[model samples]
Target: MEFKLNLTQEQKLIMTQQMQLSVKLLQMSNFEIQTYIEKELQENPVLDAEYKKNDNDKAQDEIDYKKLIKHLEFDNYGHSSYHRDDEEVSPFNFISAKKSLKEFLKEQIIDLNETDYIKSMCEYIVENINQRGYLGTSIEDIAEELTISQELSQRCLEIVQSLEPTGIGARDIKECLKIQLIEKDLKDENIFKIVDEYLELLAENKYNVIAKKLKITVQKAQEYGDIIKTLEPKPSRGFYTGEETKYIVPEAYIKKIDGEYHIIMNDGTIPKLNINGLYKKIINNEDDKQTVKFVKEKLNSAVFLIKSINQRENTIYNILEKILEIQKDYFEFGDEYLKPMTLKEIADNLEIHESTVSRAIREKYIHTDKGTIKIKDLFTTGISRVDSIEDVSTKIIKKEIQEVINNEDKKKPLSDQKICQLLKEKNIDISRRTIAKYREEMGIKSSSKRKRF
Candidate 1:
């Protein structure tokens, strides 16, 4: 009954389809973008992948370099700029997708010379093993859950423990280490004893007490502790876990050129997108109205996608460049030299919104001459320095705390307050409570827990 029209002045920030596309492109990692481009190539009739000789050569060089970098980090790694005949090189060789750990274990289980019933039980137990290679359930609980005897469950667990990687199906860290030790067939019984009874003490650096109890020298105990440190704590570390584990491809690399750091973005993976000439021709002919409209729509989408991807690349490049400039010391030296930076600071410097910077960096990573690091890792909240006018990074303060605690007398471990005093003396203005928080964050034990003979 009442049809009234009222005019009110209102302003709203609305995201258009193009803007949404741009944001999505910005948020996606390099791997994600490659996948997205592949999908777009399949779905969009007007979109085409352009691969020229120059691009092909450049991409090949980058891939070789990438392999070299991988080799440095892991085993069987090498890179060569040497070009071979194009016919000899297979494109499929570039595919580097890894098999998941569950799949890897399942294949071994299939080949196991055991009864089907027991194999099924083993499979069930394998399912219960978490990503960190620790059994998620107790043998009793698993037996009860499966309505089986504890004996059968225990046998299956032993079989799982016997599998490769040497430490799979371990219920805890102690079991994991012990499994590895037995697999190696270490002649020393004292190491087994230490794992069995004194893991907590061992972690606290109580080697002297361990040596005295085991009738061994303190030096030997220290050596055993060092050996334990070398064991693979996570059995599935080198291999893929599952979808939960993100395979990171660095978006860019910071290479120091003549003492100046330069960014080398991994854009080789991204297909150079182009409009299909046939589609453009179809539009240019202007024959059928319906055909023209359809082609125009698809062409608009293709153009928008190309524009959005370009914008995304530019935004990420700008943010990373700013970060490199700000974190020059960290790029040059190491993690301890990192300056506390905020998203807001980078956004301000780049003349963009803080949220824009955050979105651009979500799931993004950069490779440095030092090491590969997440873009977010460069940002930390700063704390004021007592004597110096400059603020100190909480990361730096944590490093300082760790260094002091490391060099302190083990029998008389520095308390949080004492650590705070030591930091203050070094001009890091931080409270005792904050120090404790940072220490806990770094997984350092409390003073009492850290004390040893």
Candidate 2:
């Protein structure tokens, strides 16, 4: 009786290779994703990182590529765009140098389907950007040096401006911050004006002066100042300087466009992946079992990798879409408008498991006008409002407490209890302990230490 085999059906969860790939991809930071992609490109012949022309059209490809890129190559990742016919390119080899600001700009320039003249102009403009990430010379000087019209030189500078490191080629700090704000679709707004003209006043903590000039409240001025402070004055801050570089590549961009928010994946960091057409042709024409089987396996792996990468990106996009829909006011206005949100809330709304949402945002970042913030920062606990049934985000509470502390009389800074009472009067009821906790979390010293006198 014990020797009999029992046939029973039971449900069990299994992680298929593709499922495992997706899970791994969902949690990888942007640099990790790039490194993973580079590895795949090296190991999988079927996965093409970019066009490597067939031998038949190699001559034509050389001529076309020569117009824009003059032997473009990266010194690390054992990767380079230019290859000799006899050279063996290895993906497994690695060094540590990342692409510099100029190299990064030139890559995008070559990819642009623009005329060679325009490409050259863009390259010249990129070259002119100083280490501090500002255009070291005036547009007039560039035009004279290039023997081109000032309008054309300005246009070329604008092209560089449109590139990543969002404010590249800016002439001054005002333009640098303004360009970033514009990338966020915040042009000519209160924050933009504050950055454009009142930067010095803001630096001096002249909120009332700015408020009087802008016809807004002092609190609003302070809010704008906070947001402006988050912007980068030096667009080249994280760029490869002479030392070893550890640059942060943003996962996505949150842009408010035409009265609606849009989620744009940062495709610039991740190379476009394509299943090699040559692999398909070989599999169809080859008769050897070993050759066909090897091609088929690689092709399947390439397809799965592409699918997993796409699934990861879409999951991130969906999460951000939901976040934007819920927190549109925050993006348009300020952090105080950020609503109560959590991973569970996003999972429920997106109709997915909670961990999926969590992993999708793990170590991920979004480039916002406020700066590159962790996507995980978007999900926060709620603190109930005193006068309404609705809730406020802990982020909003923290910002409010910061503003309160910042504006308190330095000679007699407000204590935790007094801060709590002030917040209560404003309908944000919280205990002194919560206020103290938030203050500490924000790195604000105790009120006694905060006393200026």
Candidate 3:
């Protein structure tokens, strides 16, 4: 094979700075895009915001959401109602009302005890408690700072435990329940003994064994377990700060119009922006040299920006069309039908760079009957399963594990190894580590935690 040096008259377009700017603009959300346009208008005098009048211009812009929705709707089986109008849309309630016990402790410090020293000690104690609401610090450690006796610290702690929800300042689970039982006036010698001596058995759901050892009836043991369940194991949870409750506004809407999906930018909520015509007229005047130079610079920047904005829109539409082509299954079916995909897959399919695909989906969302899902959520790595089909996702694997556990015999619950074998038999060949991973992901406790007698 020999290389040919002869040149062909091929006119390949080079990627320009304007195109880069356009990509960046396309990645921006509606609010960000509006702000960008506003900034350009302020800086560029040559780029007038005024509407350019023409004879062929339409009188008004028409936006039809319903027609667009019809196009986005997936092919029907002739009589199915999966896209029913009355399906209750669960609006994301972003404002979380979690309150951890630390905050509860701080609040009570103000009203519970008037002594500044006691309040300071209590604050220190609250700060040292773990997420499970157990006091991680020692009474001796708290006593050192307040110049108080350990006895005083213990007394204050007892008061703290008595505060609310039955168990606020417990050092351990046993202590947490003991306090709760005392608060309910149900703390007996047997209850205290069970808390101190049978806690390990109690946690393992060995209620029968515990009852036999303690010479109590099985019903009595279960009644005690029920009381334990009612006690707040995580006493500090009442003061949890809900900083994670951030709201997101979708940048675009995908509607089905007559069985076709149409992408619509959420630009209507923002004010229409354009370069000022009067400003442009002032710069174009022939008499003023300084004004002309200043105006020319601004005018050039504005024109570049306007062209960039239009380019941005076109590029976004192109990328979204590609997304639709690949994720059509997701839009048509519910989340369960979503196939495993990734940015790299889309980029390779579209013959574009991965970064470009990533930028396109960043902070962007497609609003539909399914809800405002992040555009990026459509792409997920495939899970290695028995079916030659690369359709499984980690989410689905986790769900399968949960379903298995839910149906497992309570008396002989499946262990991690057992669960892995079950999954292998089902074609989802997951390792023990993967089984543990899915178990942890679902917030399901270990067999030990799930143990019930």
Candidate 4:
């Protein structure tokens, strides 16, 4: 046995707390960054909040609460006949209103002429309805929980189902579609049968199978399917709350000028940070060691934070520029022209790790003529075609598949195999399974489900 001291020298990358914070800040959305800044402002004495000025020469933080109250009164009550005609109306009297699905249903329930017991039951059912406007609890469960008869529970369920949204209170998607179809009173018997028994087949686009079962022409089956397509699948889709709102603030902008594209970083919204001048003065003149040490530490943290923000902005800018270069055709044309790209490719080109590129683009968006698009959306897996050396983007392939399905003959909707053939003819070598996967992803039914009778 031998024990000897062996010394080895090796270089390894270790991320400091400041560096980790920089990566986290780079990945945060603009809204999230603003929130983080506010939190930092509250905790760090060396950081100060900067308020932007409007054309009215008022600091944004100095809002007029009295004016806001006046506007609200003008909008809600000023137009009444009892109000004085001489009162001046402000042009900014309008206020946005939002109503949740439950509130809307409760309002409708209030209008019903049923007994208080029945109304309460219906209200309970409404409360149990999910955000998708489907019943979250089973009639049996509701009946047991409320100590009511099953028959009463069923009646209450029916009452809730008859609400404004056609598909409201359905137990499942099949029930939802059936409710909408029954409400429309469209004279299509096979539609009901398909919804009840052959929904799986209908989803697969098996029009031929439906035709065989219903003893009708493929065209008629297609007509029935088309009618079903008009029904709303999500009864509560438009009634999403504030949490569901997708707030996208782009960090960069790409503009086309004189036949060349230019990349511009969006730093206007980001706060420009600097160490508090007063704190620096305190540190320089303070005689107490403890006070000086405290100020020095805060100043260093503030400085590091500012540096991290600048680095994040630069790194993101460079990443966007490279992406724009690679996906120039996509920007010039449309989604159909989007080329295949990966985080690794960008990382290799930028001489950074793939994770760095990923973190830089995560939850970040860029503005273009098309619209605001997520940076991550630009990168997709490539599908290699037959005759070309270059690989095609899966996004482009999905778009092409959707187009093929949209233009397809309803009586004879193309099968996944046929889709593969069509794409192969255009030099895309996608397999049938991949084609089916993409088709399903796009919410397209199979040929059998698509058949008409």
Q: Which candidate is the best by TM-score?
A: 4
- Position 176, candidate 2: lDDT: 90
Estimate every model's Cα lDDT from 0 to 1: 0.84, 0.83, 0.72, 0.83
By lDDT: ranked, best first: 1, 2, 4, 3
* Model 4 agreement with the true structure over 1-453: per-residue lDDT tens digits: 999999999999999898789888878876787778878877789986565544334432344556656546544554532222334334343344667888888899899988989999999998888877788989999999999999999998898889887899999999999988888886567788888888776666676778899999877777787787788888988885335677688888899999999998876566777767788678777578898888888878888888888888888988988998899999999988899899999999999999999989888888999998888999999999897899999998998898898898976788999999999999998999999998888887678756554
Ordered list by TM-score, greatest first: 4, 1, 3, 2
Which sections of candidate 2 miss by over 4 Å? 1-14, 51-243, 281-287, 369-371, 409-412, 451-453
Worst 10 residues of 4 by lDDT: 80-89
Residue-level lDDT for 276 in candidate 2 = 72
Between 3 and 4, whose TM-score is larger? 4
Worst 10 residues of 3 by lDDT: 86-95
After superposition, which runs of candidate 3 have C-alpha atoms over 4 Å from their true positions? 1-27, 34-245, 286-289, 384-390
TM-score of each: 0.69, 0.54, 0.58, 0.78
| Greater-TM-score candidate between 1 and 4 | 4
Query: How many clashing pairs in candidate 4?
Result: 18
Across 123-169, the per-residue lDDT of candidate 3 in tens digits comes to 77777767667778889888886788999988878766666656766
TM match of model 2 to true structure: 0.54
Query: What clash pairs does model 1 have?
Result: 71-77
lDDT for position 96 in model 3? 49
Q: Best lDDT goes to which candidate?
A: 1
- lDDT per residue, candidate 1, 294-368, as tens digits? 888888999999988888888999998998888888877787778889999999999999999999999888887
